[model samples]
Target: MRTIQPIPFRLLLSAVLLAPCALPAQPRGPVGSVRGTVYDSLTRKPIVDAVIEVQATAQITYSDAQGRFTLDSVPLGVQQLTFSSATLDSLGLYGFAREVDVTSDTRGVLLTTPSFGTMYGRLCATAGSPSRDSAIVFGTVYDAASRTPLSKAQVSLRWLQSSEGGKELSNPERTTATGDDGVYGICGLPADVALTTTAQHDAIVSGAFNTVVGPSRMLRRDFYISRELGQAADVRTNATPSSGSGIVRGTVRYERGKALPGALVSLIAGNRSTETDAEGQFRLTGVPLGTQELNVQQIGRGGVSRAIDVTARDDGTHDFVLRGTTVLATMNVRGKVGADQAGFLRRKQDGMVRVVEREEILKRSDIGSALKRLPGLRVAQKLGGTVIEATRPMCVGQVPIVIDGALIPNPRNTTTFSVPQALSGTTAIPRATTTPAPSRAAQSSVVSAANNARVDQLMVNDVLAIEFHPGPASVPMEYWPGPPPQCGLLLIWTVASNWDK
Candidate 1:
């Protein structure tokens, strides 16, 4: 009683605070957690490595091998999620990219497996020609000086682009890099078009103290199909479509003979949808019969998805056992050029010429931009004229230009096929020449000559690739002298635009 009368305000505060502690503690978080398995509708099983991305915040989680996934700390709110796999994960006409939503009444979500598009064929240097075995071109990438493989090296394939010239132009297009094994291969590429690869390495290696690193190099090679790469017979035996309502059946098992229970599998129609199952089995009925893709999801491990074909049938059975997947190596082509590598070659409206890959080519596509991306290339005027053109250092390096197996007279001449149009603010006035120009000239002389002539039927898509040969230093002794006894650059361009008809 000694201080009670004097502590009216302080005592009131203590009593108020004590009343709240006296009440029970509030519950932590909501009680329930959403859970479910993701599977392919076509192949009945769980989908591993399928990303479950939250739509609200864009936060993401991945499914496990058992096709099971958990989303912890999912606050009570309107939530949406999606499933997506890598581009190369399947062989359907399309790939998987699906979404789902969850709310107060929704506690779980089941994701259906999606299909993937395919790009299936055999590797070769020519059609109907003897198989090169290892000589078969798989993919291109820049490798280390000691041949050690890197990842994500710049690579290209030839495709079409729009140019001011109103002619089909060929330009190197970008593609994936090598795996850890210094190899890269992909499908779902443009069909019926021949593709070649060019790889470049951009690296710095010190030979001695206080000395600069060795100059990096670029490597490119052209290859084509020999009618035998994948003949009708091969397709028939290896790939068969399902029959009866277009449904297909398949099972996933281990190389050791164990069924991958709960493994997510899918049948990739050209459109990229699928069916999956709880067991390691699948039945995709009513699926289109076109060459379909069969992909199995892999969790944790990074590599190519297992692929198979779905033929046109009423119903059929196909089995798959995936081997070890491959990881691509990286490359560095920081300081180099390639055959047909252009420097934005174009004509100015005032009769002045300007080489312009630095601006014109890059605007169209990233691959075309690479023509002038390298540091080794220098824009040079042919001594007496200001017509801008690209030239490599005499001892530094030079790129070879080839069209359909035969080499083009000059790298600048080859650019016509890739960069068919003129840069913005420039124009080309065609000059009529009475006689056909020489198809092949001395490589050395062609690099030094200049003519405002364009090749007939220059189309980007038709030319397969812009192959880069690192001068004599990179070529083996066997390919020296004049043109090798065999075709070096295989041309896949159509002689006529309507040739297919």
Candidate 2:
């Protein structure tokens, strides 16, 4: 979990600001006292505890609570001044320098970081004004083993704004890819709210980074990820398991060192499955590297699941302490979680909820075809992707999609795919074509590629259950916020998690 620190980024940037801006010389001066204030140029927050020093001299001082600093009897005629701090370094606010002229007792001197307004000019759209109201989050993604920056890695940040009534309101999520420098920046985030972040490169993922971003211009967050084992990959996959995967290993033990032999373990994402050995040890190889929900169950006992960050190096063993429960009459041969089953049955009792069982789900090939089979539902094409819509006369907007326990957010400002469609289909977005394909295979591949880009489809085999609420009245009161998401809701319980509501 260590990171490569003191990245020299600040040193280089500071050097640029210190050199050759052509400061004209002032009148004759002598040794005198100098006073100054330091604050973050972006957020305008006074940065206390910063070390301010006169370069090439022993006179060094630290900024007080008000970011004020003073030096007495300094030989300060056009002297170089530098200011820095550990907080500034951690926040990416360092790398600024100033030269002060001291003819007599100097006052009103100021130092600050570069303006974020000029730095991120019109980079992203914002729900509010791009300036002041919205903020930016940028950071580097590094490879843990190499201690080097990783490019093309994905970093995501999401936050929510809820009403006083506890009805879920706006939940916006944004994601971006790291550049060649292994740095990624997401702009236009709402300020003054708590946000959660995660990074992923191929199958390797980082643990969550949570922070309450103030109404600042920017914030920096970094991630470190280790590559998966070269030889040990997903054993459950039919095709050759790629080297870019990690093993999810753990032990299922009862209290007092009792190993629970024959206990079943599975990834909620499905396909990968295994059981504990005589020692109550279980290893699930080749879990697609990222954050995934894992479910564990045993007969005559309960079940438990946790969202795990799958990576090459994870001691992420699930150690549950579940007391025995009544035997499940419908325990599957594969050791399905009793909680998952009971929860599904309980949800079926609701008149407003429409549940699709596994058998019917397995029969369908794609989400579009599967959803259309249900009553009061239909599929429509939008933004070059498929959208699930409620067929009710009064409720005619796109249905909000929820996968597992998370809601897929659709922001008004996103330039890329609307992530709510992230579950609508399983295919990529279609690319622009100059002409129709002459061969059937080529046409099929092209069509699939388009579907993939759309992020609006999913293969039916990956789905275990589907719940549809045709209107706000149909949605359970617990999840509904009074007025928003009026179109209805679609909940997909994938093989990836036993989470049900």
Candidate 3:
């Protein structure tokens, strides 16, 4: 039986071929890899948490602390890589993009994008009527040692704007933050969009987190950004590593013979200026060391100009007086009324004068609210809301308003000048006169209230009557220093009828 088996050559051949098929095919090696680093151009530091995406495959990879990233298993080909960072972007870096080449079989490539440095600044306005969505966020983030672009740093933004009618509005303008690479930008603003851009340094603290402003500091500054009535624009933010700067300190005053309260003071060295407080005092800080032209003006009164030479250690103090020429009239009130001599009292409390009440000062749409209702008088917030001046104006400092007979300290910090004096009660309404100035007994009571921080500067409950003193239409010889500057006439109000009447 063993000898009967016959071997077939065909079967033997088939067995050999089948044996080869049983062997396993080796797994294909990875196609290729894409690699890159997100870094600041200036510092050469890596950017972490930056999102890098492959445009073709829509695959994404986040950069690590060293700003290094790799996309594995990428098919061999040209790939577009997109980079994006946080929206609340930092001062240094923004976003970037580039095309990368990938070879087949485990080959990886690297990409370097542009770095962005950043700057910081603020926004301000001339008048009380505020502008909206006004500000610029621009700057370049750079390396501390090489002064190169530092594309990966965080930056934040906060802002405030003035309100219309000198009244506080509920919401101030707010904006979303932005990110960066070698360059950064965030712009889309309204007429009020003038801002001070500040840059935060990674290793350099002096120029870092400091504000960058206009033409005077142009060598180390980017540009002056202003928002026209209706347009979208951006202002540049540029800053250097130096910190030595000059400052201007002083108070603003009316040329007319008296103190000006609530008069705004604007200081302009180069496109930058801030308003003073009710006392007419102001400070222009961090001014680049140089010669600067300073223009001081009472919004509605009259503006005056001066030139100042600034130095690194300079804390220059200068005062100014604006003139009033033209005057506003009684016709501007909501309900047009003629001039009236009778003083009005607030309906709430009998003893308290209406004008002395905070309600009287704040309730109306403009400064002339209560005054307009009275006969023969009108009021307006003019000087484009910069100055709370009146027409048929009184002499400089001629109008005085006293809270409790004595002047109230200006809320803003400055000593050069006190607030504009309110008109005297007796002068405003001949029939109604102010109560006598506080005697020693009254002073003692005031002291007690002040100690408890309960002193009533503008207590709503204690008001009695308000008096408006009408000034002459023309400037008098006494009101001028030499020759009266041309200006509009303004009326003044004196508070002091009787809060406790």
Q: Highest lDDT, which number?
A: 2
Where does the lowest 10-residue lDDT sum fall in candidate 3?
226-235
lDDT of 2 by residue, 1-501 (tens): 112222223233344344424344433346798988998766678889988876646468999999999988777577777888877676665546687887579999997766656545533323234655677776678775555788888777765555587433454677777777887767677678656566778866554434556756567777765434211222222344334356788888775668888766765332356888998888877555544445565644545555455554665666655345433355445544544445455556534467777898787777776676555566765444675666432233356665653445432111123333334322222222223223555434443323223334566777788888653434432332222233456767676555332
For candidate 3, write residues 198-237 as lDDT tens digits: 3333322111111322221111222211111001111111
Provide the TM-score for each candidate, comma-separated: 0.21, 0.43, 0.27
Q: Give candidate 1's root-mean-square deviation (CA, Å).
A: 25.4
User: Which ranges in model 3 have alpha carbons more than 4 Å from their true place?
Assistant: 1-168, 171-183, 192-295, 298-326, 330-406, 409-501
Candidate lDDT (C-alpha), each: 0.33, 0.58, 0.37
TM-score of 3: 0.27
lDDT of 1: 0.33
